[model samples]
Target: INCSFQNSVEFSQQVFVHTSGSPSFSSDELEIVEGSILGKHYKVEAFLGEGGFGIVAKCRDTTTNRAVAIKVNKSDPDILQQAHVEIFILEQLRRLDPDAANIVQWNGFFHDGERVCLKFELLDQCLWDYIRDRNKQGLPISEVRPILGQLTNALSHLSSVGIVHADLKPANIMVVNRHESPIKVKLIDFGLACPASAVMPGEFVGTVGYCAPEVMLGLPYNEASDMWSLGLVAVELATGVPLYPSENDYDYLKFIIETQGQPPDHVLDSGVYTEDYFIGD
Candidate 1:
């Protein structure tokens, strides 16, 4: 599930070794070399990126010759189930808003005997890289406004459809091109997304710096949690620094308290681990 790039030989070796215990695929069938053709259509070109539970590769669609991203999930049952859920949510979103400008375009998914691969439109660099390239000077208000607006619209669309993009940060947002005027962006990476109404109690989600206070406290949350993350993203974009640059949960909570003040009495009372950090108030 490590998303870091590995050469084809290394990746193939890892996949085979990982799949050895599973009876789902043979070693030969699961071997995914750079030039290997998948699903009888797409040809894997190179490693694009990786995630905690998936490996994404840049691919070429034989029929269209268009570049696309194929995310190959680990051959684990729970991971496979999560991939299915992500595809289902994407399909529903596509049905609801086929022309949603800010959302990443999901093509389809197919199993390659060893893993489920989900195809999506290939996008440019992520906002984090973009910000880093600029030495983290942050974007001008005029530039940040458009990016924020698009992201806001995307979030609103997800909210309307009852989806919560549990993970939303600069890395999850991709710009179409670095040199493009207005810097059009698309939201990507839905690995942690889920139904807003179905969020389980005490289930922690999202990246640390961008995660909402309610999520950190294991309190019940909804789409508003995404908004809270978005607010942090906005500040990061404007200042080129994380609003909460903490390394752990305690420091993160301390950062929140220092900037936004202490949680309300009711929030502290309702938190699952309030006493773990807070003594009285």
Candidate 2:
């Protein structure tokens, strides 16, 4: 039986929609917490990055006195609700495989009256930044193998758990401890992720170039969609350039189709969708 409050919560969630809305960050009020909250303590340090859902910070946890990554959602109620949903989903993912070495570790989650904060393992550069930095310095391919392997392992594990990392761009894959012998690729940013069976076809839920063909066509997607994205990332790392940079969504879909050709017959026969939409590829 669906409780009235549960129904209200479900109704309140804004179903994922593809909007041309650019990302906006809250600049009105800044409440900086110098150290810890609840039982775990963290010294909120510097702003890492901001997104439509929240702002990530490089923080130092006082309890273990270890470096951490903190994502604090905007004060707006709508954004806060979205953060809750993200946390709820992530908590479930973490529970699914506590020892999923590829997945980023969730330290803890907290909320002050105004904002909800999520604490995660502090990692090194994102794949995009790492690639850019490498290109700038003319780094050798030998230095790139560990990063690539780690990411592949992460994606493989996520796929095994029936999770489709809808957004599998370089930006969402971070290299924790760049200097480590076998660098770890911690998959981050789940705001756009969804369970394989839960997401509907044609949701258009991913970044432009990294987005899959089905995403461009606004059709149902699955684990193969993520594999396509990872393949793109691997090619980009090999070539040092984005394979698909389309002008619009349609053009993007076309570009993917042109190069990769249409989805294989088996994929097309998945029965989740049957639209013959074509952009180019």
* Index of the highest-TM-score prediction: 1
- In model 2, where do residues sit more than 4 Å from their true spots? 1-41, 96-100, 136-139, 261-281
Instruction: Indicate the worst ten consecutive residues by lDDT in candidate 2.
Output: 1-10
lDDT of 1 by residue, 155-188 (tens): 9889888888888999899888888897888888
RMSD of each: 8.6, 4.9
Tens digits of lDDT, candidate 2, 1-281: 11122222232223643332228665334455444342246677767777776567888777777878888777776666556556655755665453354777786577655677777878888878877876744335675676667777777777776777788888888877778865567788876666676777655678888777766654677888888888888778777778887556656766766776766766656533334453222
What local lDDT score does residue 109 receive in model 2, on the 0 to 100 scale?
A: 73
Cα distance off (Å), candidate 1, residue 270: 1.4
What candidate 1 gets wrong by more than 4 Å, as runs, is 1-33, 98-101, 279-281
CA lDDT of every candidate: 0.77, 0.67
Model 1 TM-score is 0.85
